[model samples]
Target: MSTTNEAALSLAGVDKIYALNSRKPVHAVQALDLDVRKGEIVALLGSSGCGKTSTLRMIAGFESVTRGSITLAGRRIETLAPARRGVAMAFEGYSLYPPLTVRDNIAFALKSARINATEVDKAVKEMAALVEIESILDRYPTSISGGQQQRASLARALVRPADLYLLDEPMGQLEPRLRALLRGRLKRLLNERGMTSIFVTHDQTEANALADRVAVMEGGVLQQMANQTELKERPANLYVATFIGEPPMNVFDAKVEIGERVRFIVKDGPALDFSATAFSQAARVAIARRARAVIGVRPHDIRLGAGDNAAKVVSNQWLGDQSHLALDVAGKLMVAVAFDQVNASRGEIMRYEVSSTKLHVFDADSGEAVSHGAEAA
Candidate 1:
């Protein structure tokens, strides 16, 4: 890991607990340390109610920390007011004032910053053009497309010079096609501006696409935080494994042999053997115990065979560029990414093959990766 950061923002041992005395006191965030370097976009990704939102709120000073500190450009800002921290935020639910015109909405932050009137006007016009909303400056939020309105909201946050940007699911209001289009634009905007951004979203695809680094959170705890390639190639644990991929990594019980002709023992069936290296007797025994060694492989790693054997098709979902086929490999559903056309049907028995080298093995006992050293990659 390159331990260098001309860091724009850093968090060390941060925690947050809301309504401490209440029966349902939410342990929203805990013991988190992260660094966002200059010109990078980092994502706090997880399902709803995970620490992603709470962490962003804490960083933005909208929520008080139960413990730890936040620093901006090397200055501790935990106790600073949100505005004093030089932070800007765009959120879900479209927080723009409905009555204000697009131009006025984008200019609100300039007014709050006490910028000169002429400069604020100039800034407003520039922002309007940047967001492609110059033609709709007089239009109210109700009159513009939700996509345009989201850009207006985004433009509003960019009006003032700030140390960090906190975006909480800003694309939730737009349609799918527009969301995709805006995602690319948003990425380019942040990259070109060299902004330190923390974006919160549960959308895995968006998180994967936009972040320079991904911080995976779950149930108020961080599961893993690393570059996209590292997280996918070497997951820290099963939680991170299941959360980061599209259609998800396929997981099923199996045992691995660390010897010649390595064997994969799936419950209630014969062992699928593959050869070469890496697998020890001790490792195999350990994997067998979680009474279930989890074998997780990505969709593209599974090969669709021409005949019925140990697998059968369950469903074929036509996902634009590719047809994703789900199959019943024993009881666990296995998926295949047919790079070409898919013409399979339910209950049709077919031969299925797993790319053993591309397989992911987990300790059935702890749900952690088993092969370490050279095998882990």
Candidate 2:
């Protein structure tokens, strides 16, 4: 997190609403408060209709802010026209001028900045090459493929000099290999130029690969914002705990029983018993205060071979680099990942272990996190 003085963009309690003539208004964004540091890259990450796109539009001045303020480069920009906001944006729809060549489209903003024609041409070519659209520079937008047009759109927005850049699914149309290649190049370009940017992406890999930090949104609200590792290891709540992980975190409803030893009894399932020394005093106190909790364990943390718990193997798949096992633990499905292949058959009994140090406890009622591992959240 950057200090207020170092922030390049800030949204304070921003909201966006669409009024209906004869019905209740739709709140697209709700009290969004975010800050992007100078030279930092952030990703707005969420599923479709989670307010991620609406938040981007509001920041770019395409949608009106229904409440609160927007500050960019030390100026209030909520009420400013898009052009006056000093923000360059790449649209997911590829809003390129159909009549113009790709070269001219990329040069449009540079021309507006009063750069000479020679410099504009040079800048356009560099950006086009970076996005792998150099060969299509002479082609019109209407004649180019969707992927090519998307690159052209990206080139146009990135070629311009601005205080900030907002990219909406910038390389979504590109194939996997190309998308991965461009992600590296784009990251380098942003770093070399010290460009402060915020990109919208529903793809978790894209967000993790490109951004310094990721903001996860859902139901018109911001769930959590942090770097990739923090988002994985210390998710703020249940929504983020399940949303950020691969294969998702395996969660089970349980009641915490405090005694000589701490025990988490799964609802009509197995009991996870642990010594009192396994958890910190604060973690024990927090767990004791809750009537019920949802315990989460990552797939990778479930150890196979031997332990107190017995599970029936449902299925096992060796996915080239790793093995994924689906097991039925006391009637509950639990997925586990292993680096080595497991010679187990369906319906076979297997011993597994879930250490208390690998547990994440959440308040069952409010869905808020209570503790992670041995520490209180």
Which candidate number maximizes TM-score? 2
What lDDT score is found at residue 16 in candidate 2? 84
Candidate 1: regions farther than 4 A off? 1-4, 142-147, 256-259, 276-292, 306-309, 317-320, 342-345, 372-374
Cα-based lDDT for every prediction: 0.79, 0.91
> 20, model 1: CA deviation in Å?
1.3
lDDT of 1 by residue, 1-377 (tens): 22246888889999899998899988888798888898789988999898889899888888998899999987899999887898999866567899899888988888877889999999888777766678998889998887787778888887778889888887777778867877887787788778788998888788888889999999888888899988887887788888878778887777565445666787764466665444445544454444456777778767777422367678888878887987776577777887777777788876767655577778777777865322642
The C-alpha stretches of model 2 lying farther than 4 A from their native spots are 1-5, 20-22
Q: How well does candidate 2 match the true structure in TM-score terms?
A: 0.97
Worst 10 contiguous positions by lDDT, candidate 2: 1-10
Highest lDDT: give the candidate number.
2
Candidate 2 lDDT over 1-377, as tens digits, reads 22233899999998888883438999888999999999899999999999999999998998999999999999999999998999999999999998889999999888878999889988998998899888889999999999999999999999998999999999899999999999999999998888899999999999999999999999899999999998888888999999987888999999889867889998767899999889999999999998789999999999998889888999999999899999996577899999999999998988899998889999998888999997999
